[model samples]
Target: MNLYPINAGNFKLDGGAMFGVVPKSLWQRTNPADANNMIDIAARCLLIEYGNRLILIDTGMGDKQSDKFFGYYYLWGNDTIDKSLKKYGFHRHDITDVFMTHLHFDHCGGSIQWNKDRTGYEPAFKNARFWSNKDHWKWATQPNKREKASFLKENILPMEESGQLNFTGLPELDVLKNSALGFDIFFANGHTDKQMIPMINYNGKTICFMADLLPTAGHLPIPFVMGYDTRPLLTLDEKEKFLQMAVNNNYYLFLEHDAHNEIITVKNTEKGVRLQEVFNCNEVFNLI
Candidate 1:
């Protein structure tokens, strides 16, 4: 199996929102804030090449949103989904699965796109089966007030409309019981209900797609939960548990939103878990 870091692009978000109640004096040291306090972040996705399946973890925020809407996020950078895929001799059509960590606009927007006729939206990858947990699917389809904006209909419904939407399993504790991929699902509800973090086993090591749980190496600390998370205290608990496991097992964390860092490992230090090393995806490819 091979893994590629598909950098869709970068976007700006309020640093305060990204780091929650963590003081600017602390987070700014790692992710410096702009004049407006917005920090740059990547919409980094993962492309997994295993046997006949070419699975894309998440599609970065797509280009279908109006300029007025994009004005809020300040999207930048030259790396696009197509360009990144082409670097590995692949394209959208080659993707057989789109394993969405969740349905947030920035995470799943690129899953769908506007049709050429401009009449309606459509699935971006015509051949892929878009995967999401059934409970999360229901939650996103019937979004709550706080999450409605992030779960845009244009970015979602089209997958089902195109007959490519598939649920991973019964949204139960045993969801991963019969999973094909040699990975276990770690479910955390603090960020959003049932956010599935894939704990994948490849070669002799375990690499986890951290998703929003630990957006960056800067978020390694227990209390560095994003203010965007619905339950901050719960996030603190979840991070502590996950970080301990990652450190103990020497898991390579594949950060999804960190613009600069690609992969990181942690050490159990007296000051709690701390980043041990950072390596590019190619370096990790060699390890696996």
Candidate 2:
């Protein structure tokens, strides 16, 4: 099995929102803010190539939104899914599965795209079966008022419309062990309802896809939870449990939203779980 880091692009989000109640004085040290107080964030996706299947995790926000809509997030950078796939001598059609950690626009918006006629939307990965757990699928489709803005219909509905959507069928507490995709699915409810994080065993290493559960190395501190999380206390509990397990097992965390740091490991320190080391995906996985 081979893993590739597919960089979708970068965008800006309010540092305050990203850091939650954490003081700017603290988070700014790791993720500095611009003049507008927005910090850089990456829509980093992961690609898995095993046997006949090429699975992609998180599609990143696509380029279908209007300029006014995109202006709010301050999208930047030239890196795109196409470019990243090409870098590995692949294309969108090669993807057999799209495992979405959640339905947030930045994470799964690239699942669909405008059709050639511009009349309606179509699955971006024509051959891929888009994956979302049943609970998250319902939570996103019937979003609450607070999270409505992040769950864009344009980013989701088309997959079902195209008859390519599939559910993991695993309950919130169930861990899909040795599934056909070759990974164990772990669910966390704090970030959103049943956000699925894949625990992939590759090359004698257990690499956990740290979706929103741990956005960056800076978020290693249990108290440094995201403000967007619906249940912050639940997040704290989940982080503590997961971080402890990660430290004990020495899991490599594949960060999705960290623009600068690609992968990180944590260690149990006196203060709490703290960042141990950082590496680009290639450096750690030897993909290239």
Best model number under lDDT = 2
lDDT per residue for candidate 2 within 220-258, as digits (tens), equals: 888999999999999999889998889999999999999
lDDT of predicted model 2: 0.91
**Which residue pairs show backbone clashes in model 2?**
none
Residue-pair clashes per candidate, as listed? 0, 0
**Candidate 1: residue 147 lDDT (0-100):** 87
Off by over 4 Å in 2: 172-174
Give one digit per residue, the lDDT tens place, for model 1 in 1-288. 888889988999999999988999999988998998999899989887888899899999999999999999988889999999999899899999998899999999999999999889999999989889888999899999988888999998999989999887643552365355546778888999888888777778887899999998889888888988987888888889888898889999999999889999999989999999998888987734
Q: Candidate 1 — worst ten consecutive residues by lDDT sum?
A: 170-179
